[model samples]
Target: MKLPHPIQYQGSKRNLASQILQYFPLDIETLIEPFAGSAAISVAAAYNNYANKFIINDLNKPLLNLLELIIEHPNKISNNYEKIWNKQHINSVEHYFEIREKFNKSKDSSLFLYLMARCAKGAVRYNKSGEFNQSPDKRRKGTIPERMKKNIMGVSSLLKGKVKFKSEDYRLLINDISEKDLLYMDPPYQGVCSNRDSRYYSGIDHSEFVVFLEELNNKNISYIISYDGRLGDKKYGEPMPKHLNLEHIEINAGRSSQATLLGKKDITYESLYLSKALQKRIINDNQNTLIMKELKYA
Candidate 1:
């Protein structure tokens, strides 16, 4: 079974995780994710027994804390989550805002997860002042508490003793990578989503991130990057430097949900960049030949 997370994330790799995992080295000692939003890839890796150990890190402190709570105390968090989720309130929107206010003040993980689940389209957005500003989803009743409880338990079980979660910058996490480690990075879409979505990551330095990629290249680290590929006629994401020697592969993600919500149907394709170390490891064979070709020129 696939590992499922309780909260919804904007750029989650849930659908494309299997495809992405195929590009990674099968006999990896450690699997590390620096910008793990919902850690969908890590969850998939753990569930499928892809690595000996998993390291999931994110810059989002509250979200990381919430994930930790689910790992350590799934039952307790689920009980509290059900209580807030099943409340027969006067107005759902007003009640959502009330919970949001409480979460902001107390930084409660359970309330934060509930807010994310009940938020509009599960779109994680923050204001210039670093406040959770997304509105409530009026069309749906959100995910059921029991269903989320099961997902939480599943993730916790798969990750037990084999996973480590941290709230840290991507650079710091990348610096800790060893030769036997495989890294998967899913950073923010700078120019792409900022036009439509609020800046989810506060004060992120894109140029510095490029420098980290250079460091990884110099060290010959095995890694894969999921970056913005295309939206209609426009290309998105930071343009990679040729010096990095990273192979590109595009994954068709069907229609953009955010664009659809805004009354437009635009096809979205995410670009996956495989580092030179991973590229050299992709051997020529009947089964792997097709995947290798897709990575060479895309």
Candidate 2:
């Protein structure tokens, strides 16, 4: 079963979820995403036979609230979304700004979701004052209501009883993870993108995150982290802690949408840092076909 991501999230691994899941251990009783932007990995994992319980936690309240609405009241969200989507917004940009203003003032979950669906490049942006600032995509017509409804229903069904959504900082979620759980963390990148995109959501404190990883490492917890990788010739992202020994697998992510937006013509690559424990398990299971050590990032 294929499930489309309900929203387009910057630095999302929605396209690469299958490939990323291949690196996870087959016996995960619980799957958790601490920085669950789009919760793409968890959503994708829900369809897989491996994990039964899923935890999706993020500090972004508005996004998490929208996700919760979908999980609990798919029909409600669908109905509200259709009202906004099916109507004619004569000037799409002006209509988008109008919705943005309402969303900023009201913090309405339904309106926020609508904005996400219609925003430029499906990218969510905000100004320093914490207002939605992304412009409308001028090139293509937004997804039709029929398709949107189908996706909403499908994703909601996929996530129904198995998934739990939490609005919390990544650090607090860390304590909830157990040895039987597989943690998939797609934290914000450390460099330029983090600084530029921090306005959209809270930025990660790299130093604190590294310290947390060390704590997890000391406990021998298994995880797969999507952090700093490469974009064409120029590399962007952060590396693992200096003292941590982990296996790094680079996934070929095709062209970067962000790069395309910036008018650059370079292939993008993503790095998946697996805890040593998980790496050993994958190797033992003979599922390490794309190990970065043997193959170049294509």
Segments in model 1 whose C-alpha atoms lie over 4 Å from true places: 192-197, 258-266, 284-298
lDDT of 2 by residue, 1-298 (tens): 4676667676678889989988878778789988888888887888776688889888888888888887778899889988887663677677777888999998998888888888877888878777788888877547777777787787888887888888877888767888778899987778633465633477777888888888888777889898878888787765786578878888888886678889888887888888977877767656454564366765
Q: Write the per-residue lDDT of candidate 1 for residues 1-298, one digit (tens) a residue.
A: 5558777876689988888988877668889988788888888888787885888788778888877777777888889889998882568888898998888788788888888898887887777667788888987757898898998898878776777888877778766798778999887766633343474654356668779988888887889988768988779866677778889898878898778999988888889999988777655333477877889979
Return the TM-score for each candidate structure.
0.88, 0.88
**Steric clashes per prediction:** 0, 2
- The alpha-carbon RMSD values of the candidates against the true structure, listed in the order shown, are 5.1, 5.5
**What lDDT would candidate 2 get against the real structure?**
0.80
Off by over 4 Å in 2: 192-199, 257-265, 287-298
Q: List the residue pairs that clash in candidate 2.
A: 228-237, 228-238
lDDT of 1 at 59: 76
